[model samples]
Target: MKLLFIRVSLFGILLFNGFSLKAQQVKPDDKYNRREEMITMRDGIKLHTVIFSPKGQTEKLPFLILRTPYGVNEYPSPEKQGYVKDMADDGYIFVFQDIRGRYLSEGKYAMMRFSRDKSNAKAIDEASDTYDTIDWLLKNIPDNNGRAGMYGISYDGWTTIIAALDPHPALKAVSEQATPSDMFMNDDLHHNGAFRLSYAFEYAFMEEISKTDSLYQFGNYDTYDWYLKLGPLSNMNKKYIHGKLPSWNDFTIHPNYDAYWKKQALKSRLDYPRLAIQHVSGWWDQEDMVGPQDAYKALEKKDTKNQNFIVLGPWRHGGWAGGDGRSLGNIKFEEPTATYFRKEIQAKWFAWYLKDKGDGKFAEVISFQTGSNKWKNYSAWPPKDVATKNIYFHSNGKLSFDKPSAKEAKPFDSYVSDPAKPVPYRARPIEETYGPGSRWYTWLTDDQRFVDSRPDVLTWKTDTLTQDVTITGDVIAKLYAATTGSDADWVVKLIDVYPENYKKEPKMSGYQLMIADDVFRGRFRKSFSTPEAITPNKVEVYTIDLHAADHVFKKGHKIMVQVQSTWFPIIDRNPQKYVPNIFEAKESDYQPATQKVYHSAQFASSIELPVAE
Candidate 1:
């Protein structure tokens, strides 16, 4: 019921290279005090929250609130944020709360239910909870500044955006990071309509069952091989249920994008209200690309000029927190990318919006320009002048910006796709499981060379780069083909082929880094909402758009594009036989498929690159 306030210097603060000038040290008299409290809603449902404030004073200060489904006390708290302590010392109250149904918060867990439901679903909404929490904090706590700011990453980040929807009058600003707006299209469960089985299974386990100490240790695998070790989705279900894993039943029951995920996902009815906002994300964050982009675009669409700012770093999810800010895995970026991101971007963003200091000019699009390996601000994403180019594939392994000859299109590349031993894109052993936060979903060190060696994985490479080719924005792979079976799946990977000497360092020899890669569920190729069965032997064109990325194919580096039917155990193998929904698919539905990739003029297959002007 009590809040504390600290003293700040009245002296004018100066900015150095977009970094804050606030002293990094806490004064001897200034200390941070923490306490636990439950925020009760109008309906009387209590949501647990942990409050951190400056010690010693009985005065009130501006509040910064973060509500997350990913528990508060033991949740993956940012290890580097002594900033909370520093901010608390600087007369700011920091609050961390557990969204209902997940940790200490009391209520039946209603997954993703934030907006209005005609079904009369019982759940606590972020908007109502945020407003109620702020109202109580203002009235109960002493010394008064009624302003409140919100910020967090992933689920907590999503809540920040939800808070902006029908925003509280006292809500001043929010920083949302790696949060997804539409869970169906771009989150862990589904990507371009493709089901991410491994990622989702582990995700459900970590979120639902791992509440207890014993469960946390046994039920979840933070490392990479957990998916492969868990074997299959059916196996995961069996082990979880028999073992009495927490939330195992929930994960099993929510097979389709049904009411469960839908309730958890924010509705289009949710509009952005006028509030100071800073959207944050990573270009390489494997899980949620829609978070920052959607928030920024939604705000822009809503016509709210409430000091909207976007900071897109080169790091992965939570990468800016603990990473070196330069590289992940075998990939080594230039210098101090992560350091510059936190010290200059995140720290400064909070200082500007939450503390109400610095120039108010929020950059429309502040991002790290890859390939150039420098920072550039764009007036808009995919800068207006960016030229779109399509690279066509030829039968003889020839790829060019221009169309190929009729002779080059005579026969389609044929391959036999076996579901049992599917191709792995970014797979790795337990020893190398901890990939970059941005690419944790993507199996790292998964050398495509093996897949390239297979007849099933059609391989095509552009002739050595005559000049430096840089790509910014999303990449799309459009294929025209016919399958002998009723269904199929295609995964495209963009690889930076090393100069034969790319080898594993120190221990081994050469190592090559995978630039970016994506998978598409072919049955839902035409329409994600309404899936259709493929007409056997009837030519169909599937256009799969890969996620956005910024990379430079240096002068000598080769651009290798690999197409395969399955990326196993990461993604469940699509039964070649067409089925109603993958969740209900059976082993009897599984069949070997004869897949073809047609590249002739009549059925031209090509990849689209968002070529930067």
Candidate 2:
């Protein structure tokens, strides 16, 4: 966790971004004077902190702090070395801290430490530790303005958000980017009650196996094969981890959305501080996309002063924090979107609120609409005037706005979902998530045509659009599906099918771009906290949240939807058999089952789109 702060963030990504060939030539700046100190928390635990101010500073500057479970080295991190030169030039008392129990800090480490009970004075958590650190920084650090602003990416982003929940008087602004809100629901560990196999397992091993950073060595280059061959979830401990990783054990104990997860959820803390707030994320963020949006929506409800704001772009993880942002993988954007966010939005956001450098003006929501390659601003998310339109699935692999016809009774598409031969989420030879030459960063933008030929994966698409179809809000997938087994996992992907013979980019011709997607564990459909076996062969209504997006399917492009039972090792293969706890399921529980997607007038299956007015 501590290493992720520096390794999974700004500099780490910039180094790997082959797109930023131009950025690499520029020499890293090291003009700021750096000093390290051990700041004492309320519990007498000393936190590792580093402060950097301009070499020859005359005027006092507001402190911009980033608290991360990832270690902040004695010398400034690489991101501080180059990526934030703009902020450095603008003048800031930049401060970085390693949270308690992480590197250089004195205390036991905890993963995503939750908010503390305010009633208990000695109760220590990430929020309290941040408050105490700020309290100390104010008195100990010299040549600093009274005001402070907090911001970070990923884990640090989570810390930033928790700090704002119980903010201090001097904490004037917060920029929580890519922060996970609910671990068990739609972020990091699980998505709609389905375990994020590769990410969750690897992350727990990397963060918890030791105090410092560690990566679990895998034998196979294609991790999908490795995870599949590894067998049941129980083998994770018996074969390698052996009940050592805390989060892994937690995953087993709390298979359901139990009280344990409910208590620690930052989303439950809906009240936002009375300060300027900005929630930034990407539409294609493979992890934590729902987090920032969830937090932003919660803050919006209480934002009488219009302090809550959001920025949704076409990025992945910490992609927006650095790089040209002009493009990702094979997909290209209109301009250097990330650079614009940094120089225009992020820089100005803190400058205006902290230093009063600019007019206090910013959009309530800034969304980059894809396909059309344009940025749009709106007063409300899901844009208030948008109309809900349902596109139903047709028998001949077609997606139509009209309801299913009554001519055919019990109309449905059938397929055999074999656990032994699950459909790979992305192209094969998939490397370690963050390994060198890994496509994990840009997997979302990969062409979905790779799986179109698979027998088990059902593909349906609308005809070439006559005009632009702009969807600018939340998208829901209402599926009426039945299975021969008692339990299963449903994976839905909304796609944009490019017109063949596209002259602009021939290679991208016939490309199927995944716009929005998610997986839902059928057993937990009724209640996330409770599990109920499916009534086999009986159609069950499943409403899966495809999340929100702002995308445009241009004329000549087709809108497509793909439904499959398995997304490979990315999402653990649902056993298709009813078990008291999937984690403890025996090898016999795994089996192939028949899945049917109903498309009848009586039980119409469709994807709900919020077509912008």
Candidate 3:
């Protein structure tokens, strides 16, 4: 056998929460071993898997698996990453595999592979692939307990959920972090019914452009300019995509939340996971906040035995997968959240269920509430003691909890939404998604002041709060809106305005932080599947789900709301003219429109927030 050598750094890397690798070996001991194998699934196709066994383990250890479409060339080592260091110390038979058709794995890769028919004998899916791999590990690996656990972030997290659908007898625990539960509804592909262009396109270009991950080089430093120059969505095929990427093609065919999206939705197809499962999410998780939350809700319906668990922190998409979780953009979370979650929460979650080592006393829901910057534990998400309140939009740009009275002056505020110059989702010269120094991860937390003064973006704010107002649950935006065009997109944002002068953190002075926000494509106002053109210049009630959050508008700070029409690139520009398919829309289809939002008693626009008492 050929031996592989890795450079040793005698000066050890620091571990977390009082844990240290000071006594760790410069290199793995002789008893430690690594091997690569092609594990055969029930369908007879093989998947590439890499296994690592602990050095000189005293007893039998359970298997911890991570299956991913992203290349699984290297597994985490205690000497390097703090994310899995605790699990390493606990002595797991760590296994990582490239899922079907990805990297070295054999067979065709499906973007979000739908579950197979369980009644059929020859049925195969990611779940079956997992079952087959576990069967192989238990029989072939040495000194292993007959139990297994699976955990991963993002797409890997989705695969972990696949395992829970039709689990092998030995697969006893799962941890899914930042998983995309649905491609269309509230995950990566779309927010509500609006298409996510840059992400969906770039991600496909990388994932399916040749099997091994590839990157799309944007023509301009600012992708906003490149996308604008490309004109309509149809140019995507004419210029670059050109029928090669399967997912992009799928997007062109299925623009609505129709059968295609429903069939692939894991939230709808889920069965009660009988084994232990932990759902993790980040408050600012730009990618898949809807996923874990939706999955948790689906499982909650049948969780009589209490096997479901969830964690939410003030981090980005898979942000807690590494780093100290100190802060994002200009916001700081005094909580050492990522470290605590990995060391005390995620690691021990697998330990309790897989190894039976400790009492699984995890709270049903664990959340790191921002603004006040503290951690919360509850028997149920939203805590049940929460109250519902609406922050109403008032005349002359004011926000108040009190409802609008009949005596108020003007009924609404109006703005011009020009497709020619759509509002930039972030500060200008916006980098490509996943590009070097890209602020995409923390753009949601970016100071809203950039868009606050724009004529297209209208704002309403409240006076400085006299007391702490903590919001903790699903947030909904009710808009009484009118657009001059037949179609439009309504964007609503809930902001936390900082005091103008803060001596300690001078950078955050007068910061306008976004707490919860979402967009609703006007066509989907009635039904997501069957869209209808609006009667030009008529008012319509568009209710947008701003999603969930746990935040506080502390004393001396203000609560603000901003409404707008277009969020470019991130959300493909809505042509404002009704068309059968946005992907096939032409340049002539794009138009400028006057948008109005009402604050009258008859059509009071407001945000319904879940306030925790």
Candidate 4:
């Protein structure tokens, strides 16, 4: 009896230890079916990747890849996470990789490093990294069909595009969301030449800390108190410029759009190999305005497959992914549109590409037609039937399609812009951090009510139109103005005023969405790199090209145009001293400047609208 007891106890111990070992190797019954592994690049850099394969037994499956600076395990490791199980259960493989130099990946991380052209051939381009990863996975992973798709949001979006440019034949499709094509056009830095300070600093602050390749803890800025009370962007940097931050100093040092920015821009090189694509954007994403839209337009021009598609929703950032489709904040859409994007549009895109179920649902260009508040689809962007129109600024704050008469001679509105107290360009009276950092741009629609009241903002409006005027395509503003100061910034906002009695529920009462608005820092009139300040009080005609916009004004609604000298925080407060790269300018460079805008027939300031007939 003693010998039998000892044998039974020893057998139990062995069985328990074996079960623990197996559990460590693979969790039992994981829905996502996640597996962590490392893939070594050609140059010995090992990339950390978390892969999700189909649960249970399955045949060869389609693969989708997302390479992100943000960690892959943010939530449920993609596979086990909401709706992702559909892909896994439906026999699809999902892979999330930490980009080189980021967490769990080998090598030093550099900002915007993966997209640069390799003249010396020493660097690892995003394309090469993608190629190597795919090659390794196909050989090592079981049941892969040798076909893959790439999809990403923001930084990951950049890689998706870069991969498409020099793609592997096995890469069949790509879906890039809010990815910047040109780093300069509408990404992090300059828009038309204005310095995007607050947007740049906070973005870089988080990105810089994410590089430690370890766990990062972020302290709340307490938006209402700390960041807002910090006064100016310069002061915020002074307080937060601890040794850990990298991109902050780099951005502050290079205020002007110089080679530093040009090197990082994807526009310089956008030659994509043959691949189907779905590019996306939002009407209210002020920070990354030109990325997915620009990519869609460019790829359509160059791609031979004729397979480019775009979806612009009425949301901000990546709002379409996890949010409801209804209107946000003050701008109510009356329906839940975000649900359509995620459960429907996203799934359809993947199905069309991976499963070869081409439903033709998203084969066309999809954009939100505001004012009308409906979704419109076209074979291509701006459609083939659109037309262009020019609305001129007239005397006494009037705007009209008719050109100013030769007999008309009216002086322009003038005001003094003080850098110390620059006109607030960002939506005001709201929490300071709300506009740029939060979801405040929805209320900030095309409405110019707030800007029209500013002393530095010049308002020009037209009488209620007798007939409807529809506009489609790009918006170009020709400015005929001069300044008493050597340097100044000019902001142009093109607005569509609602009809006198146009009413919604009480919740969305005050929001009058603008059609389009843009700003240009004047010193870099000709070239972004070299800025030439204006001669004091000299009359000069500068062209402020606000990017493309699509809108239609009903008969009762009026059109308005506004020009302002400053838009604080959005664009850094220009010193008006004509200093080189306002980022490095000292306090002495800051000064008050007087600005004037002309509207006479001789100096006609007008907006050239691409009118859709």
Candidate 5:
């Protein structure tokens, strides 16, 4: 399901670039030619690859490659080969390849293939396959410069990072956009051990079960009702999958952060410093936002040459790849951020590295401020000059930075988390994740007011600020909570409350715009790899990483926090009871639990924000 959105996004980029090129009267030059061939890997597996180059040029040009599992026919037209028609005048050979076992390639397909031991002769991973392909291209491709560059988004982005792990001599600069760093920890599969139900299930059905790059049809249009009635996670197989999806089977067998999932993580191995790397992602990216950020942080530890950089925008998943990028949902960014990124940032990065055409001055970290609608460059991420501030949750639905007085009596709040009445991640009548009219792509930025009034959701907000308050780094929610059941799930949302006098729309008044949010499964609090039953009625600290962000809470605006147990249809219900494997839990395991959140001076439940001076 997530991959489908990525494919659509890439296609949109091609169309956008194609139209922009035509608008500028750029025509396909007769000097350029296109050809298709099968690139053989070290293990003799052949991958379908296409090459586009200048036909009659005497000077050799650099080669840029994009390897993807979404098939090489994504563009179809030779003019739209690289989706960089704007940079066609710079002159470089563009190469696109279908990953092994995806389309016209050979060998078995494995999701997030673990890096193999290079000493083993028969071991073939994406890194080895990429090294072989680059070696072949440098030797066989005509009129090619000694250097090569690799870049891609989403799944292809993952391949780009993998290729950089053990790059060939010819591989120089790499840009990995929205790369999935750790599926179980953050990315598409789960969020803090909470399984992404709609995304993971449908994605497995499409990629593993159907064996095709197509969306699975759901009988009902309202996926909210459909998934709710589906009952337990176990019914996915009993009703439709029938033990067919290998991914789903794996999900059930390894419910914890065991060796199987740990091996698939890429962050631990992102220490290569030989290649110049640029990590790109959106702050509001519906998928894989943590991937690029985490990958950059990991590489920074060993960035001897200071070659790793990060770029974050106010776009959704792959949103910077196309569109005007002026706004998402109702909020406006007040600029053509997408255009600036594509032309000034992205194209310039490639031109400087691949062509050596410019001074190559790029920031270590470039991020956009959402509320303020401006781009800011930093010498380092989470800027070293920032101060950490904790916002406490207070009584009577109030939020404050000051510590609660010891005189206060009621220092805790409680709510009922009913499994049968789980709160929807978005508004009611939720659309399918991958099909027509699906709102899954932009649900992150949806106005959060819908769930604010629900009794099960506890919301706290600060008084209208007299001055703007800006937060500029990672956001962490430190919650002291207890559940009556043996297992539980906690969801925390950071939102920006609009001023009531705003004239954009009547509904815009007091609109709660979600800034950052994430979920944490209680069983994995002690250790992700090991699960422990929650001692009922015991207050435990659960730290939920809402990832990174740069946003401003305007004067007269309010900073809001909403906490809940269940974000249904999106994340599978926890059953609120101890279960060995959620995917195997029965209907009998589903039970309601009373949840408590303590905000006393002893146990100050608060959100830590990195605030710049």
Candidate 6:
């Protein structure tokens, strides 16, 4: 139920109604003065707002809100709100809501709701409905300069981090973009504990069993053979969502990470320091890249004052609000980075904290470094003058920053996985992760030579890199593996390769380019709310985080890594053996195992990386 898939371009916000000379066009008696309203929510629940305001602008302006459970009636036409026409020339009163139910809000629609009695006073969440919609827009709208700000992207970026947790002193500044602080460990329906079965069954049949939000059809356009013949995850409630999806019956009754998914993790309630955050992410954000870097490291461990910041781009998932992010699926970043972050970083970050105008100063970490395409900044995010390194894994199909020696003699690297022939996270007829020739929003920059001649995959590479390495932050992977069956699913990628008489384009030379990947679920490898099993042939280690990255590689690039075990039907088919409830296993709990992977001097698998030099 965590699918906030709004890729922006609402038909280019209903055909761009031109007005950009620092924008200001609404009068003609306030051109159809768009207001809408419902508001209310201190427990009487109403919330469905819209607002707009600008007319002859005499000053008192600053509201920006956004909240959203996805429908503010699709901008009925305040000139179809071009998704904030680049922050409408620094004057804002905008608003727009919904968040309470699915559409014209009211109440009773809880999925990731969680506020069940936080010391009850009729407690309702999404941060008290964003502090009662910023106390009814600073007491019923009208020339509002009472300061308020909020931003969104994915699930309206989780309703702008639940409206900065307990904010409203007239809320003040926030930006979440691609949010999902934790849907069971990563985002959009489990990652570390696996189970992302075709994005939790076509995003629970397009948001809870087609209650009209459409797109569930697939009688066949190869969603990899309709999720491999929709087999088991208990045939999605015994053949096509029969329980009428209460979030797929809470994903077949919470398959692990307990306390109902750790009370819907908002990353330990992001300690708001008088709010003001930025947090947007996307280093190929195929979905909440660990929710705005774990809510900016849990608000930088209670951000003492730096008002938490982070930006990370190199687009995908709300790809910086509609293109010109200058290259993605073929990787280019030659500027235009989403029109320079919507004109110099999110319109000068809400015109410097909701309009004191400009100089609010940025860069706590503003990343965007894919293959040396520039834009760096960094004062923190994994950049304490980095250097962790590691790399390793040798004997025959090398890849080494050195380690693994003890006179190497065939360490380990077998294969065989076979859950009835799996491993195809891509390349097949594939489509439909949501309509129209979908490469599911740029399959995280495809080209890993489509699973590099998969013989049950397991690559490892190196040699060719003579200079520029420059990694820059987080990417673990570790792994010391073994798996004759007892449950498995490992994945791990990290590629790069490129260079083969490479001239600017020549079809990207040899191209492998993945740059980071993950997937772990071997019985949650020791606890994602406990699951454990593999003793079959022992050897377990399995770290896997492959998350953060800034990239660079270059100078005759090479760097590869791979290692597989079924990424099929997009992760969901780990029935190697053990089953407490892999959504009620069965179908002979799938089979075939024999995985291996070591690289000894006492099992040393490796990846680490941070580097930056």
TM-score of each: 0.84, 0.95, 0.95, 0.86, 0.94, 0.38
Better of 3 and 5 by TM-score: 3
lDDT of each: 0.64, 0.84, 0.85, 0.68, 0.82, 0.78
Query: Which is the leading candidate under lDDT?
Result: 3
Q: Write the per-residue lDDT of candidate 2 for residues 172-228, one digit (tens) a residue.
A: 999988888898888888899998899998777766766655667786788988898
Q: Which should have the higher TM-score, number 3 or number 6?
A: 3
The digit string of per-residue lDDT tens for model 1 on 1-613 reads 1111121121111100111223233334435556678878767989898876666656557788888765556321222153243344356677878777767888755445547442544444777778888888888766657888887777677778888876788888888777777666666567666677655554554444433111123333333445545444556555544534444455455544566555665556446547777787776676676567766766666655646667776665656555456765545567677777666666666667666666766667787766567887877664667677988878777677877657774657888998766665454332212212323432343455655467788877777777888787777888888898998887777676655543433432223445566677777776665678899898998878676666777776677777788876557778888877665566667788899988887888888887775
TM-score, predicted candidate 6 vs. hidden true structure: 0.38
Put down candidate 3 lDDT per residue, 278-386, tens digits, no spaces: 9998888788888999898899888989999999889888778677788887888877788888888998898899888898798999999998888889888756889
For model 2, the stretches where C-alpha displacement exceeds 4 angstroms are 1-29, 74-82, 408-410
Task: State how far residue 604 of model 2 sits from its true place (Å).
Answer: 0.7
Candidate order (TM-score): 2, 3, 5, 4, 1, 6
TM-score of 4: 0.86
Could you give me the TM-score of model 2 versus the true structure? 0.95
Worst 10-residue stretch by lDDT in candidate 5?
Answer: 15-24
Tell me the lDDT of candidate 5.
0.82
Model 4 lDDT vs. the true structure?
Answer: 0.68
Per-residue lDDT over 448-536 for candidate 4, one digit per residue giving the tens place of the 0 to 100 score: 57665768777788898788787766788889888888888888888876666666554333335666777787787878777797898
Q: Tens-digit lDDT track for model 5 on 1-613?
A: 1122222332332211112222112246544577788988888889889777865667888888888766664444334433465455567888888788777687778767888987898788888888888899988987787889988888888999999888998888998989989989998899999999988887766555432364556778888888988998888778776777788889988899998888888866776567899999888777788999999988888898979999999877777776678888777888988878877888888888888888999999998888899999998887788888999988888898987777646788999999999999998778777566677767888889898678899988999999988899999999999999999999999999999887766668888899989999999999999999999999999999998989999888999999999998879999889988988899999999999988888888899988876
List CA RMSD, all candidates.
Answer: 7.9, 3.4, 5.3, 10.0, 3.5, 19.6
> Residue 399 in candidate 5 has what lDDT?
90
lDDT-wise, the better of 3 and 5 is: 3
Full ranking by lDDT: 3, 2, 5, 6, 4, 1
Model 4 worst lDDT run, 10 consecutive residues: 14-23
